[model samples]
Target: MATLTSTSVHTSNLFSREAIAEGTMAFRFTKPAGFEFRAGQSIDIILLNPPETDEEGNTRAFSLVSAPFDPDLMIATRMRDTAFKRVLRDAPVGMQVKLEGPSGSFVLHRKAEKAAVLLAGGIGITPFLSMVRQATNDKTQHKIYLFYSNRRPEDAPFLDVLKEVARQNPNFHLIATMTQVAQSKGEWKGETGLINEEMLAKHLPTLQGPIYYLAGPPAMVAALRRMLINAKVDADDIRTEEFSGY
Candidate 1:
């Protein structure tokens, strides 16, 4: 766990909200003056005067989807039928929300000499999206390879933006896979299968020195960690953040 030097809380109004994918929404909020956070960090969010609450509480931690330079604070999540998510999903513009502590160690190492292999499952792509956007905007020299898995294109969040980023940033490569192709609709051209050693090898021929970042459901993260270890990736070189539930 990374320690935060400051845990000061701030309040901001919801500037806008829109659906980015099925059951997922992208929210932009007013960025409090002097409120700063790294690209991959997460903040605790509390809906002020939420409509409902349960054993899960009224607050949730979400990765900052917007870059540090962006004027608005942004976060995205699947709109589950839970009370918290429902309140957030239907939250009106101008609603106030509490934010605290931009904490988390799941950030880019800024290693210019080494490559970064990012493995994301479903909504786990949030933090990686921020990092990749920052890297692309700054034109960082660090190479990045993103392997994002989802049921299909419609269920995958930020697919279009990521593809555009890959196109704009020569150092950034995207390998999007669909695990449930049979149930997916429309034309599919990308790879179809669960992420495995063979897929990694196919995209990353020489993964000896590259750092690995895994984010997704607990089971997926655990499985990928085991796969990477089996593939001889150094344990110290891999950093992970697990998103609970599917």
Candidate 2:
């Protein structure tokens, strides 16, 4: 699939920042005039005149978490102790940043007849969240199955939002699992353990028909891809995007 050439760049100010999960934060930025992007896209945010610098530099790429119809652009990440994250975490509401292209081809399949099976781990749910939101808003006919795995309920970002989305969109099915729910203080009753072929078979009618989308750390993405391939799903139907982290 061809990706959008991100030639457009704009200067935007931070709108708000809030913690949505344990050690995770969602940052909203004012969208520049005439700026438009697909649901599953990413952008490079360049910090301007930071108080400090590091080997990672000032630019970081983040998936767009906010839907296209949202009032602003948003990105979420685990707040590490890195210089960039620290700056972003403490950034004033009106701080300026350079917003680069809405790059990446890891988007939803348009065929309404075929289903979309999304495998997301940790913070990798960003793009899928945008896609689900847009689908609900547009009243799309495509069926979506989201299998989101996290360490714990507290560790899962946007869990409540996704549950609400599931309630609002009948075409959207969410199966959120926890790999280490026992370690969490909060109560969880959903499926537990790493997402596997058996779990998928229980929820999905058949894995071979739907297009699969995977996103997460390198290891998780590779494992999910291998699982799909091992299940005899067509390799041509699998698409993946690995989040190396900011």
**Using lDDT as the measure, which candidate wins?**
2
Worst 10 residues of 1 by lDDT: 1-10
- Estimated TM-score per prediction? 0.95, 0.97
Q: Any residue pairs clashing in model 2, and if so which?
A: none
RMSD of each: 2.0, 1.6
Tens digits of per-residue lDDT, candidate 1, 117-168, equal 9999889999999999999998899989999999988899999999999999
Candidate number achieving the greatest TM-score relative to the actual structure: 2
Tens-place lDDT per residue, model 2, 164-221, is 9999999999999999988999899999999999999999999899999998888899
* Cα error, candidate 2, residue 113 (Å): 0.4
Stretches off by above 4 angstroms in model 2 are: 1-3
